[model samples]
Target: MPTSLNDWLRILENRMLYLSSEAAEQVRLSAKEGKCEGLPLRVAALVQEDGSFHYAIGFEDTPKDEDVRFSDKGVDLIVAPASAGNTGRSMYPFEEIDPATLASWLEKGESVRLIDVRSPAEYAQGIIEGGELMPLHLIPLQMPEAKEGEKLVIYCRTGMRSGQACGFLSQQGKDGALNLRGGIVAWAQQGLPISRADKDVSVG
Candidate 1:
């Protein structure tokens, strides 16, 4: 006698393969009670370009030009379509800048805005004194229109949030919003001076 439908489903799951509930049921019902046929299931296995398994899922048909995955021992990730190619627009590689560069730009009285995207409490701890406060959560609503060709610099506590803010600004027609690489932490870590809010506890 063949295994039951439930048993086959369990086997597929145990193997880390995927199957929709409906599809699994169809295979179960079509198989003989005691015996079973290996149903021809279509699947797209997203394997690394090198040769490691990233993820696999059963599909009805083959997809066109799947994303390439790296197979080397280095960090591997599923590169999204928007950031796949070498010259893709979504690829905004970070450009390292020192505190002196920032100070020089400010000294020259350049028409630039330092936008901060950290939380209120984090911002109060220590931030660029003249930087504009625009928390990440309010970027959608509080964002003001950017003038054409305006220069803007965005920063957050550790550079992560500010980078996201820069991306958001980029989408909002602010192409000049450069994210402060390494953020305030990088600035202070380099022995640069900092400014703190007088009422620190009020920020939270």
Candidate 2:
């Protein structure tokens, strides 16, 4: 076990895991919003049979016996043993923008890459207007090279998969990427417009 934050970071470095500043801020904000301030943020990842990865982020009040605990940029983090061993090259912060804010940006004609990180079937079922299809698992392979001043907004059926996509993009140094909070579910709940096949429907 590590003795202090420094020791923990050193261990993570050796294992090819890292924490980003933005991710640390998200951890802090998540805890505050959950009314569980001071709790550590837990991160776990696993590789699927097809080589894609799945990740989870949540808050924990206490560390488990098998957890690797550490703090960086004032954010406490816990890495599950299984995930720690299976982690990929790196991990980055998960940032999000509310549905209404995203809609407003589009309405204002702001330059943003509205990406639907869902399966083709799901995308065909319904998607935000102007959202391009880019499945979650294919993000790392399909995302274009990061460029300054470019904004990438990713969404899924719910916010879960898009959060993973944001993390993956952040790992590649795509700091401008943001996940659509609540995903299309929230957007539809807000009565926003979505495209179903070739038809445009207003949930509102």
Candidate 3:
């Protein structure tokens, strides 16, 4: 298992103790499989009128814990920290950007270093034009080498990795590292062009 996933499973296992026996077992299996990457592990429990208990696990909404219903619709959707340095990780103000505002900034000749924090493989598959490839796994090693004065606009497929990268950068005192609110998927989905050319050419 990758160390990162194994570490997540360990923390999730401890949280599973709060769940019913069946749910805990399901989580154990899911953790070992690496099937639900980038998604939350949701468990739902239902009690039949005959007092028998039933459980389901995955990303489904269901009832749990003595008649309480579990669902993300009304919840704040805050993802729990998965890594060890979460306490010290700095967070980007991602929720602050609006689409129009972000577009306006992009229109201006901003000196921000637009970053794509996906893996090298993902970057090769596709990426937003002008984005600097800085995979999330490499953030710790690269942060110290980053120049301080430039604004770092980070992004990833759906913004998760970018948010994490921003946090890592903030921990390294690069407070200017702001994540693209929606990432390249959002950018491309909105009809923006993506470039396949070797961007590292310029950085080198």
Candidate 4:
């Protein structure tokens, strides 16, 4: 019954919140603290074009009729379709590697897999050499092609988004995925080389 996009959003946000039993329990505790009892929780992805996620989460006392329903460990939730994501919590390890270490690897000609989780606009400005541009939204689709035992090092403008990507990867059971500490900002500040993405030749 929505007539416009914003109206549609008033009715829904296409995303999923997958919480493990432990994570669900933690959420339960947090909800208790927020005093959001008896109200269904909603997790909205206030994402930006640069593949950064800004979540707007809280209780929804009156969910729209068309809103998708999901329940985990007695914590009711309202979301949209799957594909929109958040792997609530990870049971695997996550770590960040400083810029110096990553630069050293590239200098030594080590076969390090570099994934750039940045928007094309941002990527066009510059990128780490040989880095694959797999924006946050595309990870679920592109990550499957990753090789076994691949040494993946993900990065962004700052360390934050890469850390999120690493955590998401960890949730997928891909162990040993490393985040570039301080991200490209640190790498550039350290005088490590950055390649300008050729709009014509960049991987589609």
lDDT (tens digit, per residue) of candidate 1 on 96-183: 2446678678778876677777777777787776777777767777774446655677777655556555555555665555667567
- Pull out the clashing pairs in model 3: none
Per-residue lDDT tens digits for candidate 4, residues 1-204, read: 122335446545543345556446645754575577777766444333554333334455555554578787788877632123442331123556788989888888877888888777788889999877877667777663346755789988875456557756766776567878667888999999989886753445
lDDT tens per residue, model 2, 1-204: 232345444655565345555455645654565577967767664544554334545565556576677776787777764332433333355557788889899888877878787777778798898887777656778874335655788888767667867876767666667778778988999999987654432211
Cα lDDT for residue 26, candidate 1: 35
Off by over 4 Å in 3: 1-102, 144-149, 199-204
The predicted structure with the larger lDDT, 1 or 2, is 2
After superposition, the stretches of candidate 1 with alpha carbons farther than 4 Å from their true spots are 1-98, 145-150, 198-204
Per-candidate TM equals 0.51, 0.55, 0.50, 0.54
Q: How close is candidate 1 to the true structure, as a TM-score?
A: 0.51
Best by lDDT: 2
Query: Model 3: number of clashes?
Result: 0
> lDDT of all predictions, in order shown?
0.50, 0.66, 0.49, 0.64
Global Cα RMSD, each model: 17.7, 13.4, 14.2, 15.9
Q: Which pairs clash in the backbone of model 2?
A: 191-204
Q: What stretches of model 2 exceed 4 Å from their correct place?
A: 1-91, 145-148, 198-204
